[model samples]
Target: MNRPADKPLYAVQDIPGKGKGLVATAKIIKGTRILSEQAAIALPFGLPDKERRKIISQQLKTLNNDARNAFLSLQNRFPTKSQYVGIFNTNSLCIKTSTDEGSFVDQAAIFLIASLINHNCENNAQQSWNNNTRRHNIHALRDIQEGEEITLSYVFSLLDRAGRQALLKKSFNFTCSCRLCSLPIRESQRRDGNVQRVAALDEVAKHQRSTAPLQSLQCYHCVLAYHLSKYGREDCEYAQAHGDVATLLVMYGDLARGRYFAQKAASVFRTLLGSDSNEAAEFAAMARDPSRHPQYGFSMKWKTSVDEIPYGLGSADLENWRWERLIPEGIAPFADIPSKEHFVKGGTSKKRHWCFMGEIVKTKLLHPVQLEVKDSGDKKLALHFYSSNTSDTGNSLRPGQYQKGYTVVILDALQYRFEFGCGINQEDLRMMKIFPLRLAKILALNKEVREFSIRHDDGKRKCHGCGAKAAVASMKRCSLCLSFWYCSKECQTAAWTTKAHKTDCKSLRDPDLRGLFFYNWDEAQDSISFPLQVADDSC
Candidate 1:
């Protein structure tokens, strides 16, 4: 493996508008550490400014001639303050340092040569704090060509152009003309929308991590997917997210997936931070024995040993398994289901849920029942139904469900190469349902009810009408759906007329639609049939 060279890979050079910046002197491949140097001066990050200034002044006096000169020469945005203190504040980097097992603290430090690197919204370099080595390491996030200005992101959050500009101006006292920031208005807004959605998903993960583990995992999985599409899983952020998924999986008692994610996290960390990094070594251990995690068995919902991992699964199936992306927490939109060519790659089916849904456009009741359906993507496919082992009559589906514009849903469905056309070969009547509404309308109802439905947390539920929190008995449920809640007759009327609860109430009347909101799809269990037994508390 090509690793960081012993010699410096960059040279401190003067750029046109940006003062002094680190310019790559040699081709730096992604994951190669360009620099790994101990901090010249380190201090706790959030100390009182006066106290920090005094400490910096003291540290300056302790440094030798060359080191002292280097620290003083760095830019001082706050020129009005003491020279050493101002320089420290202007160029300090926040790093994580571990004091003991499973405990870490953030500190501020200054790197003489590293601090000179310029900032960019779309930076090609990444900076990491190596707790084991007690050094700050700069790694190439992407391949860097010789003579390219090696840059790191000063604003790490998914902030838009204006937000990045404001932060850059406030902290670093410079305007960023980076490629992403310099994009046209319409193009920048489009990029910002995508980034903001990722950030929102992260916030959802943080809020639901403890209260709703499955929901939190869904958000993290979406965030990871976004990173994979944008960064191709090579960046530091990707490794951190992978490690987080591993930890969550172990906590949920899914040792099979926990071990897989842990192993991947370790590999990524080894590439970016080296095999010697604390992160790499810790994850490597977890991969070897997932049951050893501190949070293991918090919930045995997904209980399984590492040996339970399915063999011969294709890439898509493994990814679907990793994130639990189908059924329960994540409902696959019709367009996202695998095509026949992609799904027929041959794999051993694992113990997990798979759901496929679409709007019925045509139906055939010949030898085998079949339907032509259109998905959210507006793409059409055929569904050929086979007699299932179960003797149930699909919850006694009415004649309305057989008509055009009705929606059909199948669970644990497998893609098949049919003689007529490519589509799903659905068996198992217990895992399917046909609703009396357009696929688009039913999916919309799912989204709405998911967001506005009252929560069971702490005995207080939010009234979908007036947004007031009250105990269950104190609220009134929409008689049709038994889902939405209200505080008063007036609020209920407003929700029905203005808030458009009328349409939502109609679709949610179908018990299966409501059950989708309450099912624990993340729990590893036997395939279940509808009408799904929903808890009264789910309302």
Candidate 2:
């Protein structure tokens, strides 16, 4: 059916410092397609300069008079021997082409209108190549006001201000003074550090994706959080992280959350890449039917259908469910320390971290310190500390924290085969924690916290002070840990004094301890470590 023509979305106009660039003529809502056009010239990456010039010349000649004028009008950042070749080189955008065998290769193409959209470090518009339509589409990532410059990011500008300035000058032949690049010195340095940290996290996710998909998934979630904190979540990278997390969740048989993230991905893709783009369609389908994904059922441990999505949840509770929240205490003794075989075969376990508790039966202080510790099962094992942190040892533990029967909690615990017997090769001081209490007592408290601290459907809450089950509201919650409850001042005083709640409360206040319990163990957000900055009671 034929329809009335819509008004043009944008117009090419003079941008003070940017010369001629696209500017929004009318209000463009987020996710609305600003432009969708085919390339005038295309060339595969890694072609010889001579061959590239020849290709550009051929494609340029085939264009109509008006198209040729628009193509030639594009900025030539690098003025080559041939102006046509220079124009193609400067204006070309990356377009990925895949083989029949499902392998992808990079190709660069020049689009008439898209080539005129100027660069911005924090662009309101996103550019994408439509795999199905074989066209370049520009979509408003965020709502663009009429008369606002319609810009797209020219580079992955996760670089420091100096680096960004240098790169833009060298490659794009212009100095960028975008908001990010124009920040104050101190703020710029802080932003640069976050940039480096995000880059490092991305590398970690890539490396751990195969060996530790759970860890990789957590890292991707961390990336999403970083995106939320620094750049807004509407960024291209942030949208991609949503898809990455979705894929991992699906592989782990978490269809409920996988579909949720897929839905988020689909929404962002629709807004950033247009609904007709391959990315949007692919995620839309996955959100509708996650079981259709190639990696579906890779592991059924977290098996749940899309219908399992919780209803009537508040935003905070929804986030906790969305990011698989971990109960540090509950995970403590679920599995034995991983042996060398497990690590070598690639950690097939969904968890990237675990806690190993063992009581100190013997101690040997030397270059490579050794400690004989006993676990809950009364099984004794030798722990050899080959850690680079020489200052932190059993003696270095808090005055009363280390004792004969005191147990050490090692996060990301691993087992090794020593000449004497199978034991732990202690490394990374941050991962090791020496509780003043015995392993049995520590575990008992862990059990208590799991049962009593949390609210039940029946409104019953266990008083940390008296161990008495009471109405949830009748109990006074512990100021710290945010996990323990108390009955009355009388019970609270008695528990704090007589019931050993004093020492337990102190331990509960430890960020590292709280970090363990609240950290997402399933498909969650935020990858935590020691010196943890944990959020106050997420649930």
Candidate 3:
């Protein structure tokens, strides 16, 4: 039991069910790099049986007395008698599937220090491959308290109590008894349901092609956005999430969204796994310049430069930026539709973004059957006039229509009772509305409204310090204020000196400010006012 001077930080001791494990000496802060050691013995990936034996045998010959003793002390859970096999079984960790292509085999050089760290279905540390250093690194994903075992997850997905037990028995060979794995049957069932839902979403998210009930960006967000509020585990899963999204976007030929999601994934992985990790490095490179990607310029549908990130949007707005769902399409923007409103009570489905936009091809009037005859897709639909639009000719509406184009906003496609009567069928009035303009003309007018009414730019790049629209790629915003960019030294100087951007810049650079630019406010449940502070930048 000879432990190092960092005594209270960690000590080698027997762990119940999981052999000799390292117990926390003192509280370990999340994101703190725990240890970094050179590999004592290393070999090329996927060696033949004879070659693997030769490599391990050669490495054993070079070990000093102390190193040999350390190697001998690891827990060997395997039913093997050979010391060589025992050490290999005891000191091994999962070789990443991404880096080491094959089955879930163990890396032989995983040190005693690394191997002594135990497993928990819900772990406090994240382990990742740092390809640059050809070493593995562990960072505290959440704070680990003193006297607690520093644990990491062996499997990728968040499993339920039953799922976790099964995986442990089949793969890592242990029955978990962690707090999360030991809830009461009912409570455990609820937690398991949540885990299963999250896992199901993750699986659907990763392999969307194979999953049924296919979803779009809007649909995925509708289902998974609630997970942020529901699970702490999802916070660590952002990298995987962004990667899945990036993959989906790429397949759809939307490089703009693909690049954005890839960049976001890269950022999250870099934070959790370190920038040198393959996931971080690959994504970071993709984010830097999307054109370099093999699929770049594959389609011009959603084209935008990487530096086109907005200057002053709120958190939800920034999320829209990251997702590329803010762009206009045939349907209403995803940000404009609320998921709760899309589904009825007891899980009945309501039409999403279904609104009637038609032109008045003809008009007929008769008491009750008073139809404002209109052209809906070149077919005449009976729009029984029901509004209290009091007129001199109350029931005698004419053939010459009052307007050429008319618009209608319909809520749930429900039929209601008609109080005013003229023998008009209530169903006819139920599906129709008259808002004076055709759908095509309405959309044109909407574009003009966006153009002339709003004083802001088209969410393009401008010097943060000065109100100058600089070239997108060449501008860099002040890191602190983030609200403004500078084209060059002169512009940055002007911002810092003459414009008083120094103060404004600092205020705008706040994470809350950044968060504002990230969150979507159009279909928001809660009103997000100005001076938005950053809550957490997980998105």
**Each model's C-alpha lDDT?**
0.76, 0.73, 0.55
- Tens-digit lDDT string for candidate 1 (25-75): 988888788888888888986787789888888887888999999987888
What are the root-mean-square deviations of the candidates from the true structure over C-alphas? 14.9, 13.7, 18.6
lDDT against true structure, model 2: 0.73
Best by TM-score: 2
| Runs off by more than 4 Å, candidate 3 | 1-9, 13-17, 40-58, 80-83, 96-109, 203-227, 232-236, 250-260, 320-338, 341-539
Question: What order do candidates take by TM-score, descending?
Answer: 2, 1, 3
- Give a tens-digit lDDT track for model 3, residues 178-297: 777787899889777666766675656555433321344544553345445444444447576676666555554556667777877887776677666777778877766666776554
Task: Provide backbone clash counts, one per model.
Answer: 1, 4, 32
**lDDT of each residue in 1-539, candidate 2, tens digit only:** 01111777888899997779988888888878778888888889988788988888888789899998888777787874478767777777889977788888899988888888888888888888876668788888788899999998878856667777887786667888888888899988888877886778788987875566655765676577778774445676777789888887888788999999999988877767767778878899999999999989877766888899988866655665676522232344423443442232222233345577888887765445577888877788887767565675642344344557777877767667566767888677666777666777777776766676666677687776767789866778877556677888887788778877777888777767666555545433344346655466442
> Which stretches of model 2 miss by more than 4 angstroms?
1-5, 98-103, 157-163, 329-539
Candidate 1 vs candidate 3: the TM-score winner is 1
Scanning candidate 1 in windows of ten residues, the lowest lDDT window is 338-347
Instruction: Between candidates 2 and 3, name the one with more favorable TM-score.
Output: 2
